[model samples]
Target: MNKISFMLNGEKVSLYVEPNDLLLDVLRDKLGDKSPKYGCGRGDCGTCTVLLNGKSVRSCLILAIEVDGQEIMTLEGLSKNGLTDLQKYFIKHSSFQCGFCAPGMIVTLDEFLKKNPKPDEEEVKEAISGNLCRCTGYVPIIRAVMDYVKNRGG
Candidate 1:
């Protein structure tokens, strides 16, 4: 086991993890942060998406040791009091169904909007292209993002 230190959900954390353990496994199994789901083990699925230093990445493809000293943000980190504006927007727009892909989608969208606050339809689709959602058919999801951008004056 190797000791790794990182910031998780705005808190400093240190844990012992195996060299081969994926970051997603360490976060969910060891740290008890279960928002990042286990989807395709490969990087193709963004169900395990998390933010590392303000950028979104697939946690399943990253080893726990590789994240040492980094600032990691999971879905749990997005909300302070209650649902974040984006999350509220998602709910207001009925952007999700089944919700398996909601966590990854929300994280990815949050990062994307941070970068491109006023993203157009095409850009919004491109931003979440890496994540796959079998439910909601992408319409309400995209609409939710657009609505949030409009209301935020982005």
Candidate 2:
């Protein structure tokens, strides 16, 4: 096993990981980070999304060893301080139903908002297109993000 060290949720963390072990597995199994759920193991599903060096990526598709010296941010990290504005907006808009996609959608949007603080409705829809939520039909999710952006002066 190769030892890998990376910044997780603004904290430095190191652990032994096999070259073939997926980042999602290491985070959930070894590190006990349960936010990045194992939905579709393939990259098609965004349920395993996480931020890698401030960018959204599918943790399931990345090898743990590849994150050595990198930075990862999961929903657990994003909410470490408490409910972020986006999260509050989500709650206000009732964005989620089953909530399985909440973490990935939130994480993905967190990065997107940082990149494009002022995004149109279509842009917000496109940003969360990868995350599939069978319930809520995505209308509420879009509204929540748009509202958050507007409230943030974007």
The models' CA-based lDDT, in order, is: 0.93, 0.94
The regions of model 1 sitting more than 4 angstroms off are none
Candidate 2 — which pairs collide?
A: none
Query: What digit string (tens of lDDT, one per residue) describes model 1 on residues 1-154?
Result: 9999999989999989999999999999999999999999997879999999999999999999999999999999987567999999999999888898999999999899888888899999999999999987899999999999999989
lDDT at 3, model 2? 91
The digit string of per-residue lDDT tens for model 2 on 1-154 reads 9999999999999989888999999999999999999999998879999999999999999999999999999999999999888999999999988899999999999999889999999999899889989999999999888888888899
What's model 2's TM-score?
0.98
Error of 1 at 147 (Å): 0.5
TM-score each candidate: 0.98, 0.98
